[model samples]
Target: MVRGKTEVRRIENAASRQVTFSKRRNGLLKKAYELSVLCDAEVALIVFSSRGKLWEFSSSSRKLLGETLGTCSAAELHELGNQLEESLRQIRKRKQCILAEQIAELREKEKSLLKENKLLHEKFKGGNMLHLNAAEVQSMEVNTQLMIGRPGTL
Candidate 1:
């Protein structure tokens, strides 16, 4: 079956646009990888999405990505595994540090709020409330008129 050429234009729909971008980007990256492997050429491709997200493919980084390992011996693979584990450990440590800092900040905020609440509770507990008599309540009857627009006009 013959295929018609797709028109080169920005997809109007946001979801369709993102989908097309993702598919095309993957295809391009795969082709770059194929070219590098098949021709024994060093290939480096970098793509910046509309939202400033980055997609990159480098032959040098294939080992880090675990893409190519045909030439890697047992020792080399073991070293690569160790390197990956170390990288993961560092990442987890940094994540824990940030989480700890955030937890400490939240605890401090909770303490401050609790202190403020206790002060407010003590102030209200001492009791400064109105205790009006029957005569006073009759004298100060509430007006329940609903007003709208300019005061006198409405």
Candidate 2:
């Protein structure tokens, strides 16, 4: 008969534990080999058994676990750095374009505000113009100052 489901925690029985360990160790090594083959990748796996036996596997011996991947020579490193720098430069160029557009929009808003201020000031002066003469303009300025509770020389 088949056994029921078992928890993944500590195995209690000693004989069953040994059998499980051997089976899992083989399975893990097989999986590592299959992964390296199927993915076309540099793979390394280090496994230590319960008896302290160490097992390791790698696709290449020269390019070990501690070694950097894909870059065997200084030329490769320089080429890779250039490619990365160009990509970053393109990203910065796009950011600069966006900021330039925002600056143009702010400048347009400033111009609109300046134009609106000029129009309002013209309208206020038109309404206060009883006569276009200099003396009449002076008198109007004095009257406006008095209305706003300001002392006027006129």
Candidate achieving the largest lDDT:
1
Q: What's the TM for model 2?
A: 0.38
Q: How far is 52's C-alpha from truth in model 1 (Å)? A: 16
lDDT tens digits, residues 1-154, model 2?
9999976765889898889888988888888889888998766667777789888787654244345646567776676567557867997999799899879999999999999999998987888753478867666533352344555733
The lDDT for every candidate, in the order shown, is 0.84, 0.75
The estimated TM-scores of all candidates read 0.47, 0.38
Candidate 2 minimal-lDDT segment of 10 residues: 141-150
Per-residue lDDT of candidate 1, residues 1-154 (tens digit): 9999989765899999999999999999999999999999977676889999988898765776667788899998999899879978997999799899879999999999999998887776665313556777678757889787878884
* TM-score of structure candidate 1: 0.47
